[model samples]
Target: MQLPGTTLLVIDDDAAIRERVANSLEESGFNVLQAGLAADGLALLGRQRPDLVLCDLQIADMSGFELLRQITELDPDMPVIVSSAAGSMGDVVEALRLGASDYLIKPADAPVIEHAVRRSLDRASLRLENQRIRERLERVNRELELHLKELKDDQAAGRQVQLNMLPASPWNSGEYRLEHRIIPSLYLSGDFVDYFRVSDTQLGFYLADVSGHGASSAFVTVLLKFMTTRLMYEQRKQDVAGPVAFKPSDVLGHINRSLIACKLGKHVTMLGGVIDEAAQTLTYSIGGHLPLPVLFAEGEARYLQGKGRPVGLFDDASYEDHTIDLPPRFSLTLCSDGVLDCLEGTTLREKEQRLPTRVAEAGGEMRRFMERLGLDPSRPMPDDISVLVLSRNPA
Candidate 1:
């Protein structure tokens, strides 16, 4: 069907042929322009920018092929149909190579002319639509790239904050030395650890693993730090009696209630301890942690025994404190369950059985223990891993 207001320019040296083509197109709902010379046709094209062009292969002022080339340079997508009285097969192919939309024999009927014009217009419209779709996709891709960059920047900032909250590593108080390492599966970690002087005679430390990983889990680590710090301050202030008021079980209980009150829908597995340097005793508590703490002494390593419900998950959750006489030359290692992945075992029972052996192989030193387990902190891990080693004297 001929489109309404579709303008077609007809260029032919013969005035009779030019008028006949123009009149036929106009009768079929097209607005037609007629030019008997090539120069006139090019001028009309520059001014009118018609939707399609019909040109004779031979014209008085210029070659039809040359006019087609110039039109293509001006608007490469313009559709041009070339008609000739005696066009050879070579001529038809040449016209097509010059970007003609169609080649016509001089005796073609009006219906044939109309069909060629409609087909070329439809193809041009389809091309225009495809170009529009491609432009939209490019725009969308640029926007997505920008959003991903912003997200990465935010995560980097969050990671720095978590790093700052950590206590100094390889810390020394009295004859005891404390060291810790945390490896996160992503830019942020859900595992945390800390050691600080509780009093002139006491040193306290703990390792906590929050459920889940990444940003949300990392946020919970911040809360854990705040709760522990504030609890230590409050206990020291109120007790006036002794640092014994700062017990590991009490600390865990306080954190459990606080997390439940905040309704953050998260939980933690932790192990905490208080060391009395003057009396040479270690009092510790556990909160649903796994693989238990390993105590290395006299060149032997073994897991300590303890069990409790995970914090923040149960209102009635309680922790128990267990006391042990400190061996003069000893190392106590606390690890988050993520270390289980690095352990060689087919089952939980097998992995637990192997942990103490691995600790003994590393001699309870944090660096050697990591190497013995083939754990590379720089590489990606499936979960967050944390290690806290408290040692006093060496063999």
Candidate 2:
């Protein structure tokens, strides 16, 4: 079948052969351009840039082999068929060697000429289509690379923001020392920890594990910070005279309400506490978190008692306050559930059972305890891992 708007050039020294070939191609829906001299054909090829060329082996101005070579040089993909009355094997081989697409005899029938022209045009069309498709794929790949770079840049900035919001590790106040480490599966973490002075006599701290992972969960950690910080500010503003008196349960409840009101569709499992230096006591609360905080004192370790619903899930989810007297020389370790994955156990129950024993092995030193748990930040993890240790009078 003829390609739409197809143009063909015919070159031959014999007027009868050239006109006959041109008439046959024009009848088969091609726009035909005839040239009796090789020079005219080359000039017309450069100007019109026809889809296919029909050239005679011998022409007045130049040999058909020379014209074929020049035509291929102009456009290597251009299709050209050579016609010759000599019909010798030598002439046929020479025409093909010079980049001719097909060979035809001088007295060829109309059907034979049309079939060759259509086949050559079809092959050229396919080559052009493949080139277009290859270019499109390359362009798409370049765009995807640019978008990936932009996403990585955004994650890096978000990670820095999270790092800046964290409390300083190995922070010391009076006889108490606080330290923490977080390992994120991605560039940003869904797990978060914070500790700050609520007043001269009280210190506040919490470790929260937001639902899911990546950017969305990391965003909730920022919200948790803002909610808790704002809650403390409001409570302190109410009374500027004495030490700030607020319960850990109160903080958790405030966060629950704030998160639910914002309709974020996310929740948090957390453990928070306030340490009273004067009273030598730690009042704490839990919000659907596990495997509970472990307290190591005097070569022994035990889990603290607290149970509550996860924050931000329900409107009526209430928190309970639990209090314990502080030991003179002790460390309390708190971790997100991601730590449980690294623990030595096949079951959750088995892991929880072994945690207290692990704490006892570390002997109340924060760094040693982290080593025992294999909490290395540089190693890759499937989920976010966070550990917070609060110690008073190190052993």
Cα lDDT of model 2 by residue, 1-395, tens digit: 46578899998889988888889878888899999898999999999999999998778889778889999999999999988889999988888888888999879999999999988888888988999999999999999999989999999999999999999998998888999999999888999999999998999999999999999999999999998899999989996966787799999999999989989889999999999998999999999999799999989999999799999998999999999999888899999998888888889999999989988998867788779988888998998999999999854
| Pairs of colliding residues, candidate 1 | none
Q: How many clashing pairs per prediction, in order?
A: 0, 0
Every candidate's lDDT:
0.91, 0.91
RMSD of 1: 3.4
Q: Please give the distance, in angstroms, between residue 189's alpha carbon in candidate 1 and its true position after superposition.
A: 1.9
TM-scores for all candidates: the values are 0.84, 0.89
Instruction: Return the TM-score for candidate 2, rounded to 2 decimals.
Output: 0.89
Residue 260 lDDT in candidate 2: 97
